[model samples]
Target: MPIQTSANSRLRQSVGSPFLASLVSFLVGVSTLLVATLLIDAHLPDLSLASGQPGWLLTGGFLGVVVLTGNIFLFPRLGSVQTVVLPITGQVLMGLLIDNFGWFDSPESPLSVARIFGALLLILGVLGVIGFLDALVRRTPVVGNSSDAGPQLWLWRIAGIIFGMCSASQTAINGRLGVVLDSAVAAALISFAVGVATLLLIILATRTPWQLKRIDDGPNPWWMWVGGFLGAAFVFGTAFLAPIIGTGLTVMVILLGMMAGSLAIDQFGLLGAYKKRATPIQLLGLALMVAGVAAIRLF
Candidate 1:
């Protein structure tokens, strides 16, 4: 629990600002990823792009910067539950739109009623996770984790929601980039490297102190050291799957995995996360989420 509690407080304080935290973390994450990418390329055959790749395809990395910063801003304002769920909902919706329209040179995957119903169920699950029903019963507002509440609360929430949409957009865009590069690993490498450069520029231009190593020294989880590896796996996996499965389906599958992971963390109070026992309401919500995923992808 110290790791979890310390992680949040340290991030806000040590990095000086949410903007710095986001950029610095992204810088660290991408730096870690760049090393991984190089190692993987050396170890594995055919990891690199075979031919010349387009210039525009590289924009996916910048979008990732946005995603990281948005999450950084949202966590303090929205708490863990909403931080994860709201973005997920927005991302799923964006993925659907991208697939249905064939945007970003993606293949068409038309929308259907089952997918819509599934999305609704997923939303229902989100409400349960946040204890929306519990709040209603208690006749109280759902308070976020923030110690301070004021006018900017709504602004942060709105910004958080917008960031969620950006994240979903990035997924789709990166998937297309993967297609262009002809190899997912190549796209992942480019994305991470680009993100690292962008963060580096921001740090210098804004005069943010180099706090990239700060996360490693505190009461942070050992996982914090491996955040880069975790992040690398995700970005690489997104590029790997997005084009092949389409972003909507890819995100649906990813959502299921995330739900399971989130449940485990919350159940065990992993990383010092707030301890919330899995009640029937939460279970039903999870079941609905799974069912919704099935409806969208399988039905």
Candidate 2:
């Protein structure tokens, strides 16, 4: 076989699998992030875990894998908007439930009537964002090949939603860990390290080859390597803010930002995702989400 010179080329060479491409990309990004986090932590004066909390709280790293890997899988089929929206639908709903009952050791911030309405709005907003309404109006087939495409697409979407819920739970878990550890940085570091460890276990269990050297093969988009950093930012942000605002509100705020970022990424075709414009309906969906977020926060 001819030598593969680029990242995409290598991915294509791997049995022509996009999943493998995404997997490799994610692994590279996360590994890069773990190393960077360690280097930065080395300079901090106190790096010990302060709280003698249960170790299971560190599972935030595994949850990061679910969210990031799910994104890579959905990016091709759902594009950017649906990829972000559907999961966020699950996120907001779970968040509401979490706050209502104080799940995962988060503080009890019961869902009020405003929050219930906000949850409904968030659901409708997701459907609108993904154009389910328009697709229904036009009677356009939502997916393809009826037999295979429809089922497969639904499966992926469901998986994405489940991943979204796991991510929400992970944020709450990490936040609690932060309470125990007394440092957001420590919480984030633990999550990233755990995530790296989990990925390594997965690779070993599946007997996949370690492709560390491939990152140096040639030029690629700089953003492809920022997965770990993005993950760290999220874990740290959630850890730092979850206690102050409660997991539900924190997730809503994050969801708002996610919506804005997803819209921009799709609109501009950023990061190699397909370019798709935000239609008037989708814009309405975005407005609804903003309103819902506001309702959840202000009321």
Candidate 3:
């Protein structure tokens, strides 16, 4: 009886171990990412303007794949909602920090009232879209298994928030980096390197199963590269323009571009996920976000 009880205890601990580790990893990953953005900004202040040199943009794309792939593995285990929400929240906070402190390149950038309002509108729009989607999903008969539905539905909502926050942060950080790195490719490479290095350390320390074999399957998917490239371009472009047009204004423009791209990506379900039809509510949300952005720019 004693031996049996001990075995059962071990089994319970083993089951819980991954969950605990994943949570720790997620927090650490986010912290590292925030630090990395600052470091990249400081490390390559002139990366955007490098001329007469071979561009390293492709390398950056490769690194993006590595970073995202790592996320894919880590997210599911770490509660998809948390995986999405916490990062997004972190990004927003970081953006505010960067803007207020002039951490990277925006020394004169101040977090104005208009910018705060814009950010809030943007957050609301995202939440509205997510809520609408959850409603739609619940209405589907095919997805009506209560037991399976409850957790997943909540998870998706959480994921959406996280994704939104992360997107915002990505915009701010990349934009700041863009100021220093002239070529989008170079910025991608440097950021990718940081992401890859961070993940690699995690893998080494935790003995996580990272599959490099996945990269050799075929010519890499264009969409996978798109996120990184677009991200890089946005960052570079934003940085270039942020100084001339305040940080808030720069993000406003980028958000518009992101909305367009994200809509297309979600509508088609291009990455093997179910196609997400954009409803009226989503359009309304987008409009509100855009309007808020525009207002920030004008006021």
Candidate 4:
């Protein structure tokens, strides 16, 4: 009886550890990203009065490298869901603030009703995808059960919302910053640096020893990294493109791309995670997300 009890305890602990790790990773990732943004913002030159600022471009490039490295380390711990969800949520919320308050740029920028509705629809679609994925996991015993439940799932859902907001906020940041830095490569570099610095700081504070043993030990799927690079490009590109394309349009298109990319990534089980094949419901949800984007673009 004692042995059975010990085994059960260990089982529960093992199940719980990854979830805890995911949460920690999510927090660290977001915090680091924000810090990187701050770093970029601080180093930005005033290009309003002057035409071009070459130095700011250099700084932005450096930052982009930092952000990319940070993701390389952080994503594994957070898992794909939390890693993607948190930032999406952040983008949605921050995007609204930046658009309405114009905190990062001219205060004259105003929020529109269409954009708000579009954001809502986007959130609903994302939730639908999450629910669909959760259901798939539950139905497939082969994949095993997800540790997420009750409040924990909600927390992750909220994290997704934050991630959305982060995406939007980044659009604003990039738009404003572009005026000074004026180059996508520069902005990407700066964002990367911020990402790296934040992760390094958190690792140091947590006193977590860096482990490289799992690096090459996991799946050798090179395609997964391609998705990551695409994601990185989308993120950095959106920031650079937002100024020309407008935040609403940029986000809508990027979200469309992300939904499609995520489906492909999740379907293949590319990241050494569960393999829950996408179902009709998920496809429907993806369509809805695309529709939401279209609505925003047209209206």
For every model shown, the clashing-pair count is: 0, 0, 14, 43
The C-alpha TM-scores of every prediction are 0.78, 0.76, 0.53, 0.58
Higher-TM-score candidate among 2 and 3?
2
Backbone steric clashes in candidate 1, count: 0
Q: Mind giving the per-residue lDDT tens digits that candidate 4 earns over 82-116?
A: 55545655666565566567555523335678777
Model 2 misplacement above 4 A: 1-52, 68-86, 143-161, 212-218
Ranking by TM-score: 1, 2, 4, 3
Tens digits of per-residue lDDT, candidate 1, 135-234, equal 6667877657886567677777667667767776677777777676565666677777778777777678878665544545665444444444556678
Which segments of candidate 3 are over 4 A away from where they belong? 1-86, 132-187, 208-235, 238-244, 251-256
Error of 2 at 130 (Å): 2.6
* Candidate 2, 1-299: lDDT as tens digits: 00111333345344244334445544554555456546755533133554465655768888877776677677777665567667877787778778889887889888699998887786677666667666776897654322336678888778878888887888899898878767676777777776667766666676765343333566545544444445556667898899889888888777666666767767887656678998887788778888887888889
- Global local distance difference test of model 1: 0.69
CA shift at 18, candidate 3, in angstroms? 15
In Å, residue 22's CA in model 3 sits off its true spot by: 17
At residue 27, candidate 2 shows an lDDT of 56
**Total backbone clashes of model 2?**
0
- Compared with the true structure, all predictions reach lDDT values of 0.69, 0.68, 0.48, 0.51
lDDT of 4 at 121: 74
